[model samples]
Target chain A: MVATGTWITQPVAFTSYQVTLGRIALVGLVALGLTAVILMGELDLSVASTLAVAGVVMASIDNLALGIIAALVVGLLIGAANAFLVVVVGINSFIATLGMLFLLRGLAFVISDEEPVRLSNIDAGISFGKPLIGEFTPRILLFIFTFIVMHLFLTRVRVGREFYAVGGNRQAARDAGIPVRRRIFTGFMISGLVAAGSGVINALERTAADPTAGSTVLLSSFAAAIVGGILLNGGRGSVFGTLLGATSLGILQVALTLSVVQVDVQNIIIGSVLFIAVISDPNSIRAVSGSVRSFLRGGSVLSKPSVDPKEATNNG
Target chain B: MTSEASGEATTTSEAAARTADLGDRGGADPDIKRRKLHVLEQMANRGIFFFTAALVLIAALFIDGFASLENITDVFHRAAPIGIVAVGMTFVVISANYLDLSVVAQVATAAVVLIGVSNNSNIPMAIGLALLIALAYGIVNGVAVGVFKANAVIVTLSTTFIGLGLLRWASGGSIYFGPSDGPIRSFGTTEIGPFPLSMIVLVVIAIGLHFLLNRTTFGFLLKSYGSNRNATRLAGVNTALVVVGAFLISALGSTIGGFVLAAFSNTAVSAMSSGFDFEALAAIIVGGTSVFGGKGSVLRTLLGVVFVSVLTNIMVLSGLGFGYQQMAIGALIAAAVSVDALARRAAGK
Candidate 1:
């Protein structure tokens, strides 16, 4: 998709493609955290809201270090609150985080007074986004470093692998003596921390914190995670996949801009692609095929319920 | 070990003796006590009612102009649109299909289509076309979620983008009804003996849906399906049809809401209903509908809508801005669901 869009632009500069990586890094930072939480069979819809809240905090403070620390602490508290709701209070992760999303979004608006907050140290903020080495800015380096560290955590760490175990089967994991709740709590905390970091980077790049900044990024991060093969069902996926997903999405956006495609049209394309990706699940595929076969065989089209792959395999 | 075993035996025997003592005293006394306990339990179960009542009392006492009849009517008028959409959302949530995030976009489509088509054609035709488009959206969403068994949240999210994008591209951003004096505008603003027409529509729809949910076979099947999908399917219920029906009702609600909103504003734009979907969902969840599904009522949703609208109204009257209102509502959703979860756990559900 990127190549085709770039091909139409006449001068297909590789440099433009490299520039797109910076945007991908922004998405990657958030998506990496999302990937971790999803691996634990939980969703964190509050990531974007937390990002906005953190960005607003970062923007309000005059000193860079203090601002970043305050932002991280805010993110950590929000994550801990989500953990208390989901892990301790036993609310569904999706609903709890969704509630947090709304609360944080509202808090962002309240703190910022529904207006954009410009960073006090404009030069420092701008420098963060400036390329330091061969098309890699400080923000991009942070994202890459976070991705690498997350990759190692999930792969090499014992506690990290237990997130998969907990998600795959909670009862069985408990029976096996895994600290399931603790793992989930840790996952959300890291997710919150990483999302805050992403917010800081975004504010640095833009030099302002807008109350509505994270609204669009919320869905985009999900798209990135899903497109990179992170199953919504959890107990599977990797940060590496999210990185690739973010990269492709960034490239697609860049390509569309290069080809002068309208924003609405771009949305249509992206939505359609997401729809296709969601339905392309193997379980959905089998269900579709089974229904088609039954229809062809003159059996009742809607009679047979869609067979759950996990259940079907278990039965077999 | 022996002492612990004897202690357990003693506890059981003492409990048995107490039961016998109660039986010996009188069945009537126990029955009255049990009845009182049952009433207390019922009240506890209806926690949302108390929460809403508390908010109303607080608002009435603290906020100026809150206790007035005009402000009360204004609250209902404000709630009408969300109530309409949330009534549909009740079914979707009860059926365990989760949220229809695309309703926001579907609403915009209806508004845009109504104005655009009305200007090009006739008003009635525009209404029909707008509803038809919404129905098409519902069908696509229903098939994806019901037939293909895709995740409801993601499927609806995708449809939101698709619907919004298509509407924006076709309408070229915004469209106007192009007339100041029309029947549609009157329909939006009309009042019958101090009651807004939209509020009446909401009430009628709510009553109709109450019956549909409590008295109909489809409602029974929908509830059962939500409670346990595999069990419902095993019982030969067309679970997919029930889900599709739920989505259809939701679509119908969105379309009607759009029509009302557009008529009131005399213009249609993609951003008009931006936060409406979440607002409706919040009302539904706040009204004591279990997010887990299989149990809810349109009546509860009605109270929820009223509660949310009243709270926002009170905030406005008290010099609070939209930001504070959003925060309060957001906090309410989390608190409501957390309380529900705790109650469910206590009940050992």
Candidate 2:
């Protein structure tokens, strides 16, 4: 019975292997740019909106080739704006991205005129976007390519190391001759650009540009990032973990969906998983020996503050 | 004219004396400094929006029926539901521990529970039952975050889904109400002395919240924990209990808002409040409750509720549709939160 239990519990034995892989590829690609900003210890709430706008921009261009190009350029511009606000204007990442969220959502609505815009022919929409190049889903291909390039850039490039430095401790990074402001700005830009790309992809998949679509995903993204073990304090997590977090969450949701569970139960289950992950020490022995090992290659640690609410009240 | 209206409202209060401290930079007699900080704090969090000075200016100048007593009552009436919700949010926001996003879900769910239980009879009992359920739901939210030590964001968010799902199931996947079309309809419409009874409920909630936030030990404890929990614990406070208790209060706020809606809307609909949680959050943040932790006020939230209502009313009157309103509100919340952060960094607080 114990042997059977272990066999059933092992993820390898789980029939959701395909779903997990698919989610990992899709969500990982989307989370990559966000990983850049998070590494610098900043939160970008506007990425989802950026993605939506980029998707809409792609739709307008019509030609698939141009659509993809338009999405990237628009994403870059938005990213630049996000960076400018956070690094130069000194707005906190949260507020800055939030502002960007409004601006982008507004632009989307105004341009779309509060109407859903789509390619009239479904095949035309997917012919360019959905084709698998000899077996690899385009999204999967894009995901792999993005992950590889991003991993290389983050590890091998001069600027990539700077991202780590700034995120490690902004003050220390500054002291070590990093252009802290510039790096931080660059991080926000990446956040916007990546989200834009992802949003555009989402549009292509659904064949519609929805201005309001991104808002619902914001908290989930945060939950994923946190569960993947990225620290709000910064400098302690990896893109790999974030990707893993997204995949794990996405797959878990799919698995729940396949079961007869109600939406509330699904939510309860996912919420529990996220909560446990957030509070549990990242490097508990079981966790270390578990799947987290394959992702980061190193280890994890997070300290908790000791206090009861009443004592905290009295002190304040 | 807006100033005159305020002057009329505050002829008897000391709040009138402290109104313009914003102009007095570097006036740091601790008392004055505290007062100025208080005003600025209110502005950053929620008060500025509620002030209606801006609303009055626009309405007085741009709107044809702006200053009419009828319009005044209408605006207050509109502000009532949001005010009640905001009153509860102020408690949660100030506790600096948890944020309750499940109110819309509660309201929707409770609306269904109340109406369904009424079984086409004893509507008041149904409304009362809904209030009881709202209270129970609040306890659930309180327990999930407080006892579990869960991240309030995820917990509340999921709770929202849970509430929404429960509502759908209870209603059998359809909205189960029609025109409150009866005496209960007046719960939302009845007015007294050029003022709305709904607004009266809002005002009472606001005053009650203010006293709870400022004039009590529990309030002080919440503020203290919000500022620094570790230090608070070291000082011997039961930080968890305080947070739990804070959630309980937030739940009560949710119940009041939900119960009122149950009485007024007379129908419980699925996905009826899909956007409500976000709007409440936007209002709370716009009112100036830091998403991070610590520092906010009921008065500011009151202002926020009014500001949002008037802003919506004006935008609708001006004929800009819901799309622009959303965009504008997003901008407003972002701007409000940003300015608050900017002030904090400047003040080194």
Candidate 3:
């Protein structure tokens, strides 16, 4: 950020930082939900589209509170529908969510009539959009609060621990008498609820609901979550890591914007970063570190260390 | 420990006994009932074929211009590129790595490369360069997935974005128009007695792929890898090679599809083939190809291609907007996948 500020004008850098931070706070909310679903060995590609739907719903409704409630309800319904297709109907989560992604995006387009819905009332918009403190928007504060609550919920709560078990191994979790299906169902619902919250925040921040708003959020949020150390395969990650990841991405975006890099180039950079992050994940890091240590100890890194079953069994 | 061992042994023996009983019942009164269920499952597996035939018949009976030879030919022409891509996708899916989302990006890249290169070079050189570019992209994906064991969806998805970005950057955000005087253009525009030349190319490619998949040892290894990678590896198959081959084949198909599409439209735009990967996937899934891998047929994908084409044609004829069309496709994808899941469940797979 200092480099960006130095490269560009300070005012422009500050504005870019503020805008990117605000935008990614909303994205961070979605990423938090995505982290949970991904940790549970499932994916919800429809989060972005669900956000679009919520945005549209919130934008279309006259009453602010009513719109917010409606959007949340719509999100929950979408989540339930996804759970039904995945858990009850037995469709693979990837395929089911992919379908939902398109379905919901299309629905958003239909609902919004392919136009951006602007929030007409300034007072209500200000309440949601204005910063609660200096340089900290309501959305950003909500994001931080949600992050803390979710962190506690996942780390401290019993059901949250069960989510780890289920994601780590569904059969094992089932054998252990966990309500695996219900846990998975709830994970998706939380994802849905968070997605809707982000959508509302987005609508408020922009003071309008654009039908195409969330199209790019899916990949960006995934990138953020993955960079934050969330495994795509499931069962390990944290909201705090995701918070840092989203912040880094926001900073990266701001930096790129200041650098005048084209959007396409920015996409390439993001894609590369995501690839690198996934490849250099914790397991990979451990393997590399072990091999390096072995090499330093004057042992051939490629040579397999002989293992005694007795020793292994005793350790276990 | 002793009790746990005994408990596991008993469960295994009981399972064995149950299988023995099932085998015995196969020749008894239950056999007929089982046979009926088997037949039902077969029908469900072939549901899309039946559905397509029924849809065509219904369209013929009801919709205007639906039964016309000209319109039918047009549908086939329109289906050709995606069908070709779907054929390749069938292999990738059957290999159990799931869908290749990069195909659309590959197609666009191929198209742009073909046009951009052909402008400065000969037609043959341009085509070769475009294919080489696509093959390189395939190698990158294959190595990352096959060698590094990266998640297929994430890797391919990242590649998709990267490919799109690189193509856009390279092209300077401009669309490329194919030159008028080449085999590529002729292939795109020419027809052979009521059929588009491109459709004929699609048929030839389909036949070739069917032979490769069903008649070759390589195909067997590919399917085996998809079914059980560990077992295949234990059986002395190079699983990485199989995976790489599948990705290459997928990229090859996308390249061809891109080339044909660009030629047909006489233009190469960065986003022209956006969402095509999903469309090919839909066709592949609709054709009864298991998304989980180890079971699928190119012929089934062919049927799926036609089915989707006819459905889209009918929808467009009915004057449905793009939004509704997207919704319908999504619903179709969900329905097709659900049917597959139901069939798999019924079959105890």
Candidate 1: which stretches are off by over 4 Å? A1-15, A290-316, B1-44, B175-178
Candidate 1 positional error at A73, Å: 1.5
Better of 1 and 3 by TM-score: 1
Residue B67 miss distance in model 3 (angstroms):
2.7
Ordering by TM-score: 1, 3, 2
Clashing pairs in 1: none
Q: What TM-score would every model get versus the actual structure? A: 0.89, 0.80, 0.87
CAPRI grade of model 1: acceptable
The lowest-lDDT stretch of 10 consecutive residues in candidate 3 chain B is: B19-28
lDDT of 3 by residue, B45-112 (tens): 65765576677667766777765656666776778889888887788899888789999898898888
Please state the Cα-based DockQ of model 2 relative to the true two-chain complex: 0.23
Of 1 and 3, the candidate ahead on DockQ is: 1
Model 3 regions lying over 4 Å from their true place: A1-16, A120-123, A282-316, B1-34, B38-40
DockQ by candidate, in order: 0.34, 0.23, 0.28
Cα deviation of B257 in candidate 1 (Å)? 0.9
User: What lDDT is reached at residue A169 by model 2?
Assistant: 84
User: Which prediction has more favorable TM-score, 2 or 3?
Assistant: 3
